[model samples]
Target: MSDLYLSMGRKEGAAGSLYWAIQFTNTATTACALRGYPGVSALDTSHHQIGPAATHSGSSYGTVTLAPAHSASAIARTTNGPVGGPCLRTGSYLRIYPPGSRSAALVPAPWKTCSGIFQVGPVNVDGTF
Candidate 1:
């Protein structure tokens, strides 16, 4: 995990769905590989989980090999619930666990979500859905 850097990248919205690019950069001297969906969940200001963790989406699970300074990305999608609904809440951050790793990295991203139930896709080198 120390050899990787995690950050939120581009974002787009359509209708009631919000999508963000979760970027993973190889910061070490050699190459690394990432596979499958990363674990994602929303967090409050106190670093506590705000709601349920993100669910896995899509089926293109393939290994992405990253050279030093290279990057791979996954798409995270969340839908908005009705206003004043119990599932609607604002989160201050996103906790991301790289695939097959126990360590996590938090990225500051304040946004409204439906019970923090994000749908995350597999890591890809193209950084698109």
Candidate 2:
């Protein structure tokens, strides 16, 4: 398997929800293929998993071929809430596992949720900027 690097993208606020792009870059010299939804979870500063695991939103899944230095991305959406809410859970990092891969990469992402649920979209072949 090719080595890939995961990075957190900018957060975009829309309506009463928030969306963030998750970038995946091919760091290895060879190409790699990625498909479906990635496994994502919030992690505390201590590296412990927090809240419920993220869920995939879209039904259709497709494979993306990643060439060296090329990238693919996914979007994660969560409900926006006040500073203090009944569903609040804070995490400083995100553990990401690419589709069908066992290894995980840690990406820095400061997150607060009113609901423990996170809906992740599918990976785009073009990366959709």
Using all chains and alpha carbons, the TM-scores for the candidates as numbered come to: 0.89, 0.88
lDDT comparing candidate 1 with the true structure: 0.84
lDDT per residue (tens digit) for residues 27-98 in model 1: 999999998989988888999887688788876778899999999999988775653344646889999999
Steric clashes per prediction: 0, 0
Model 2: per-residue Cα lDDT over 1-129, one tens digit each: 348889987789877778888998999988888888888888999999888778988658678998999988988777787523455568898888888888888888997665555888888865442
Q: Residue 42 error for model 1, in Å? A: 0.4
- Top candidate by lDDT: 1
lDDT of each: 0.84, 0.80
Q: Find the number of clashing residue pairs for candidate 1.
A: 0
